[model samples]
Target: MKALIISDSHGWTHELKTIIDRHRNQVDVIFHCGDSELSENDEALKGVNVVRGNCDFGDDFPEELIESVGGVTFFVAHGHHYNVKMTYVPLSYRAEEHQANVTCFGHSHVATAFMENEVLYINPGSIRLPRQHPQGTYCICEYDEKEISVTFFNTHGENIPELTVAFKRK
Candidate 1:
């Protein structure tokens, strides 16, 4: 299965629509880590999975969520509540509690993807306002029963070669 992960859009509906149009049917799932700031009525996310961020005021979105896909469990959150900018301690603990194979979040506006102890952790950065990096970014995860591969993509929709990572299921 394949998944498109994005976060911290901060209300860039037009860009979000472009991204959805490009990957909607190609991936098995779409994850929005939050700060969408878009109304639920917007059709840009007809079938996307999303969580709320601190900036997504009054949106009725949950602070965290869990989902199972292709035999893998995913823990999704906005990261601020967990103090992501400081460290991953709290988030890692939460992932362990949730027994998640993958943990995804957004808050720092920086893209990161790595695996530790057979678990995948990803931050898709911001599509609207990136910090410390000029390029806006997102991530794609491809997995089956044996292995998984992750790739980060820039705003131009080009993959960042050096940011790719491959993992074997333990």
Candidate 2:
């Protein structure tokens, strides 16, 4: 299965829609890591799994989400509550508790992906305001029985070659 992960849009609905439209048919699922700043009933989030961020004021948004797709369990969060900018310990512990194969979050607006303790952790970065990277980015993950491949893309749908990574499932 393939999943498209994005975060920290911070209210640029048009960009979000463009990204979603660009990959809607190609990916099996779409995840918005938070700070969307859009209302819960907004069309931009119609079919995406989303969470609440520190900047989000919507009462309808959840703080975290657990989703199962193609035999893989995913732990989703905005990461502020776990203090992800300082450390991953809290988030990692939460993932372990959920028995998640992958953990998706956004907070620092840094694009990064890695595997630790058999769990894949990914932060798609901020499409509206990037920090560590030159371009605003998001991530696409393709997974199967043997391995998982993650590719980062710019807001314009261009791939960030150097950021692409693959890992063998444990």
**Model 1 error, position 9 (Å):** 0.5
How many angstroms is residue 29 displaced in model 2 relative to the true structure, after the best TM-score fit?
1.1
- Itemize residue pairs with steric clashes in candidate 2: none
Candidate 2 ranges beyond 4 A from true positions: none
How do the residues 69-88 of candidate 2 rate in per-residue lDDT, one tens digit apiece? 98889999999999999999
The 10 consecutive residues of candidate 2 with the worst lDDT sum are 53-62
TM-score of 1: 0.95
Q: Which candidate is the best by TM-score?
A: 2
